[model samples]
Every structure is written in C-alpha cells, then in structure tokens.
Target: MDVQGVRAAYRRYARHYDRYFGKVFHDGRKLAIEQMAILPGEHVLEVGVGTGLSLPEYPDGVRVTGIDLSPEMIQHAQTRVEDLELPDVTLLEMDASAMEFSDASFDHVVAMYVLSVAPEPERVIAEMRRVCKPGGRLYIVNHFRNANRIISSLERALAPLSQLLGFRPDFSLDEFVAHNDLDVLEAHPVNLFGYWTLLTAAREPTCRGGASPDLERSIRSH
Candidate 1:
C-alpha cells in the first residue's frame, strides 16, 4: 500500500483495531517485550503504534515513543496513554520512512505488523536501523513469505492485491534482513499457527549468522 492508502486504511481500522486485531496480535506483542528484557529508563521506539495496544506492557520506568502515520490511529494511542496514565509514553503522527528523530535516538526499536503495510518497507526499516543506536535491538514482528512452496506461491499471487488487502502477503525475510545491515540474533514463527515471524537484530553490528559482509556493504553504499 502507498502512504496515503495506509493512512486511510488505518484511519478506518483505528476504532475497531483493538477489538478485531488485538487478540490475534497479542502474543507477538507480549513476546517482543518479554524477549527485550528492557531495563527501567531505557528509551524505546515503536513504529506503527496502532491504538497503543502494547503501551501498557512496557515496564513502568521505560520511556516509549510510539509513532503512526494515521492521525486517527495516533489519536487513539494518545488516548490510551492518557487514560492509562502512562507518563513515560508519547505518541506521534509521523511517517516511518522519514522519522524526525535524530540519528541513534533510541536504545531499542520495535515494529509489530508494520512492514507489510508500509509503502516502502526498505526505507521504513532503514529508518529503524538509523534511529536505533549501534548494538541496540530492533524487533520486527510481521508475516513474511513462508518456506512452503504452495503457501509461498499463494502469497506471491496475492502480492499484487496488497493495496486492497492493506498488507503485502509476500514479504521476503532473507532480503529484508540481509539488506538492512542487521545482525540477527534469531528469527522464528509466532502467533496464530505461525502466521507471523519475530526477527530480532542488532542495528549495524558486525555481520552475524545469515548476514554476509557483501550484503551489508551494498546497503551501506546506497
């Protein structure tokens, strides 16, 4: 989906998002935070913080900045933060591909179910890598193309209809991680019969596991 499309779709989804998507997406959100082992006072940035569903799960002392492109979605998140008395949480209406934050502004970054809907997933992730500190964590929880050929073929066929669907069905995990310069710690299935995957990585660390030096160089040069 394009930027405007994403905004419009999320605006429509804002009110009923938690009701429809909350439970299905809950386990991934919980797992991301728990795996983070985030300490008190750490600064965390969440891209596409729709309706602030994950706001309360964060540890009390940590500072959270949640950004969403849709003003309507961000508005709901703002309300959640306020009603919950989440003093350390801030919600902003901002573009993920071009965040206003300075370089290395956060200690950790998390984006749950965001990449598939982003108009430019590469740029959005590049921004995530830029804003997160070196050696800091980047947690991405989203659906990617599956290994099974039959399922993957279905996803590929569905890719062309992503705008209508509001999410791309054929995102590639290998291309996403390799080109982002991420030092992946681990990647595995999560949520609803393994429909989504959690990819935890370090921003711009030495190539580790699946990331090769040449791939890192290619992204760095761009």
Candidate 2:
C-alpha cells in the first residue's frame, strides 16, 4: 500500500484501534509487554507505538520515545501518556525506514506487531539495529504465519483480505534476522500455536559471541 493509503486507513481506525485490537489480541499484547521487562534509566525506542497501549506497563524512570507513521495515532498516544502522568516520554511521527537518530542511540528497541504492516520489514529491522547500542537489545513480538498445516491452510485462504487490511500473511523470523545480520538472542512461539514470534537480539558486539544460552536452547528444541 502507498503512504496515503496507509495513512488514511490508520486515520479512520485510529479512535477504535485499541478497542478493536486490544480485545482480539489481548493475550498476545500482554505477553509481549511481559517479555519486554524494561528497566529504569534505560533509553527505549518504541516503533509503531499505536495508542501507547504498552506505555502504562513501562517502568518508571525509564526514558521512552515512541514513533509512529500516523499522526492520529500519535495524538491518541500523547493523550494516554499525559493521562498516565509519565515523564520522559516523547512521541514522534516518523517513518521506520528513515529514522532521524544517530547511530547507537537507544539502549533498547521494542517493535511489537509493527513489522508485519511495514512495506519493507528488512529496512525497518536494519534501522532498528542501527539505532540500538552495540550491546543493547531489540525486542519484537509479532503474529506470523502458522506452522500447523490446517491453520496454515486457513491463513492462506485469508491472505488476500488480510493483506488489504494491512497485515502480511507470514514473514520468516529466522530468515529476516539472518538476512539483516542481526544477532538474535532468543525467539519464542507465543500465542496461537507457533503463529506469533517473540524475539530478542543484540547488535554486532554480541553477534560474534552468539546469542544467549537460553535462546540457543529454545531454537534447538524447536
């Protein structure tokens, strides 16, 4: 979809975005936030931070900068941030591909369910990596194509409609990470039986050392 199309769709859905998605994706959203585990004093950048659903879950004293493509969504997020009385929070309407930040600027980057809608997931991933500090982390929680044969068939059937609705049918988590040279620390199958992918990774510093032990074991087991 073009920029205008994306903007229009999101604008129309901005007010009801959270209510519609929060209910359908309630469990997945909660799971994603639990996995983030942000700590105080950390600098975090949240991409596609629609409505700031995860804002209240963030730890106090941590600096959060939220970026989104839709102005309407950002407006709603700002209001919610004010309602929570959160300090050190900044919201920017920007493209993920062209992030206006210096290299290694963030201690952590979280993009929950953001990639699937991006026109270029790889470009966004690279940008996310670029902004994250060498030893810092990138966390992603996204819904992907189901691995189960029966479920996969159902997803295939709905692919066309889903795409028009701003959802990519399926993206290979492993391939995307490896292609971008990202050091994936951990990946978990969360919600909907291997349909949702949760991942944590670091930049180049940890790449040579390899991913975390827990992550290795999980990947090996799966």
Q: Tell me, by TM-score, which candidate is best.
A: 1
Top lDDT hit: 1
Model 2 lDDT, full chain set: 0.76
Clashing pairs in 2: none
Clashes of 1: 0
lDDT of 1 by residue, 13-62 (tens): 88899999999999999999988899888999999998999999999999
In order of listing, the candidates' clash counts read 0, 0
lDDT of 2 at 10: 83
Q: Looking at model 2, report the run of 10 residues with the lowest lDDT sum.
A: 208-217
